[model samples]
Target: MSTSFLLFFALAGSVVAQNFWFSFGDSYTQTGFLDNEALPSVANPFGNPPFPGFTATGGPNWIDFDTTTHNNSLVFTYNYAFGGATIDANLVAPFEPTVLSVTDQVNQFLQTVASKPASTPWTSENSLFSIWIGINDLGNSYFLSDNRTSFDTTLLDAEFALVQQLVSTHSSLFDVGARNFLFLNVPPTDRSPLMLAEPASAQAMLKANILDFNSQLVEFAENFKASNAGVTTLIWDSNTAFNTILDDPTAFGFIDAVSFGTGPGFFWINTLHTTSPANVFWAEGVADVLEGTIF
Candidate 1:
């Protein structure tokens, strides 16, 4: 066999060997999940063309890249993320009422577990559950107020609450025999185009809020691990990855590193999202960090 074929087999083997991958979060992690419900062809399981969802990349998002191209083909990918979802809807709700909140997504997973088909089964050893949220939660809060002290306090409490919910959700997932997990924290939203347009003082406050949220997230992960047994978890710091790219875009192979647009060289697709090129970079960073942990 040729070298390319051998390499393909190696990568495919890694993916097929894993039990299942279930992703839960907002648009950043969404890939037309609900659209899959109506798709006839299982080949493009994510419902790409007619149902691109709200992927900022203008194409397959990271989850799509991992389950489809990255893995060659995934055994199964149950992505339950909505474009504007939040951990708690009361804290932040997507534009559509049908969008599943983080809690709702977890509940849906539980329902999926209960009604799983015989052809596709899940096991604790091979299954992976990942979550990447909190941007909207912070975004809504930031937009609601400009007071640094109040926003900071409220955001921190919300982060703590989210972690607590995760602990409970993981316990339930564990009961159903899901062990491996990956958690991606919030990135630097303050640096995004929309936020960048804000006054310097507001921008600085937003950055500080993100830092507080991420710090609390780390602590929550530690607590969750301590409380649970035989569960392997990896928290990918997306914040650091984003910052690194912003610090030196050329190093990561970008042309218009400073500009924000949909064209070549630009990073930010809008004030709220990154371009496809930047998404690829972000996806690679995530894949690299998950190297030894998941595979």
Candidate 2:
């Protein structure tokens, strides 16, 4: 066979040896994306996306994800998420790398899925897939506005359309074909680093934007399921996830981490991402959702 065929077979062999696990999206995935290193560029300082005009110490460097668990997973897995990326960034303007277009992102997912050999032991049963992007699309605009009007109705309508397109296209891969799909929802941007450091005046303006994004997210997910049939997409709500401890930190059993500032009830290494315990906790949430369903 040709050299390309030889390499393909080698890769297939590796996949056959381990289960199939794939994760996609931006910074949320970045904790597990950057291959165990922190990304200095496209950083979110305050802990998640921010509110309008709320500036922070610097760009986000969410480096506290549970790499040990992410890295430990031996499956033929890869994280193709680029920081500063948004759900609609595919159709709208680009964010960080802008080089890899939105279509390119989708193709990356397709290629990874296609990479698995039909004869591989992992099958659709134990395979896992996840997509966790969408905050930046709305958060970036809100952070720039410094006012409450960022919740422009026109923009939100467009956002919903973008969500529809993403789900529709991605669904084809597994909607009726592949196995389990972990579809993540938007985490509240008001709690992001940008909003955290901003003045109350500016924050008051962006609150609506946060609401818009969340509303659009809920709309999209519900609409998707309502419109489609035989869909097995799972939603991971960091909004609800964050709310659990946002009001009461001690409940989650958090410790203080200087870099993350005051405290979100846990040690956030930085203003934005989670510390090791938190990272693993987030991972566990994903893992739990993936429970026996994977096997």
Candidate 3:
């Protein structure tokens, strides 16, 4: 086992139970967990294929690392992320028709876990809801003929609208006491191997779209927190975290920033996705946020 895994186990004496994590996102966060599958248990919190479930990173993704390795407390993770999910299919179609969008994921949560069922008993105080979407939404539309500015606005409007629905008084989650929320911004995908192969102008456009989307996301999060009472909101700036590694890959123990391979030193595992080490860094950062251990 890795040192981090051993460290997590060693800290079991301080583990606090009943801390639930409801995660929703795309490939970067997917862990192939199904609601009907074997539910999470103390021995195996993820409770599906195995410890490091099917992931796009070629190993464990951020959700897997956060739940098992980086977490300070024992958290039962219910990940509803799919491989090609967008914010909403109506606004931005996924790579596959069968893929469930973030909207679909939220609806799934409402139907299955929102009511505080007997099988997965979760309370608002002990549970946290997180969404790390918009990668596909912007990637699918950034190069399209549609007006980029207007389309980005439409995407975020729909995104925050769903957030509103979750926190609304009439919503199932609100009635069942669901308060904590964490929103992760889109990472610096323009620096990915796929985008590195693109033209300079194309790369610039994609970067601009990412920055705009992330800026609006912060605004929405601030507004949501200001307007909602008794709600805890956090925005994890994943873009900066990815850029920090990309800027100095060797500092993070990566051989280089632009390489793509299924190896320890490579920063990326594929053209568009990062390696498990990169995901581990992300998980550690998020764990710090959740544990209030970072400034």
Candidate 4:
């Protein structure tokens, strides 16, 4: 976290309602758009049934918290995340061909702007756009021979380019009046249940890669902020948040964060996903960050 973020957190509550929230990323941030056939609009902003959408975190993920509990009546939610998504088509393909890649998700939003009925009331000033991706990118990249430099040039560099693509294309988003942006760095994947099962050396290597990816992401966020005046951008320290609880689950209110057993209420429900309790904590942190930056 930066001193700037700390300052933002201290004064975020005053931000006026965003009214609309847009999310894009992989399964961790995904809310099963394909499963619900959801669209971004006022009447049915979530989907047909208006459920939380299927999430690996067991139940209502971060977006759920943002839209349901934290948001006011004026706010609406539209999640465009899919399981197994990557920043671009180069990393991992979606689980199914129809699942939207991060790029695809953003393009879909652009299409919505271009085609929505004139009466539709989405304005960039009243919306918040968030992206939580890059897990699969690093997860797939780390074990490919353990060479750090190779990982940076091939995987990290490519990921940075994708970030640049999203931010620099502000014209499309900014043209439509979207000003608030939130970028989540990759979490501590080495602490996840599956990574815990790996050997210590393997964990160390993967951890190093995650740190490098996050460092580069921070750089991108800073650059985007400096160049794009009037756009509010905040990079949530997901790595720190995840590692804090992993270090002391009880401190964060988890009954047993270390125990990744079968059943609900554990830190992780499977080799890769966590339960809603953890997601709720993350969502809270994100809400703070949003308030800090936009309000």
lDDT of 4 by residue, 191-247 (tens): 887887889988888899888878877776677667777767788898998888888
- How large is the C-alpha RMSD of every model relative to the true structure? 4.5, 10.3, 3.1, 6.1
- Per-residue error for 69 in candidate 1, Å, reads 3.7
The best candidate by TM-score is: 3
lDDT by candidate, in order shown:
0.65, 0.48, 0.82, 0.68
Clashing pairs in 2: 43-60, 44-60, 46-193, 46-271, 47-271, 47-272, 50-195, 51-195, 147-205, 148-205
- Predicted structure 4, TM vs. truth: 0.80
> How high is each candidate's TM-score?
0.80, 0.61, 0.91, 0.80
Q: Which lDDT tens digits does candidate 3 get at residues 41-133? A: 677787676878889898888888877767556678889888899999988899889999999998888778788778788886778889999
Off-target runs (Cα >4 Å) in candidate 4 are: 1-18, 34-45, 92-99, 114-116, 145-177, 261-264, 292-295
For residue 29, model 2's alpha carbon misses the true position, in angstroms, by 0.9
Top-lDDT structure, candidate number: 3
lDDT of 1 by residue, 139-233 (tens): 77755665645555554456445444433444533445555777888899888878878898888877887887777767766776677787677
* Ten-residue stretch with the least lDDT total in model 4: 1-10
Candidate 3: lDDT of 59?
A: 88
Which candidate model has the greater lDDT, 2 or 3? 3
* TM-score attained by model 3: 0.91
Ranking by TM-score: 3, 4, 1, 2
Candidate 3 least-lDDT 10 residues: 1-10
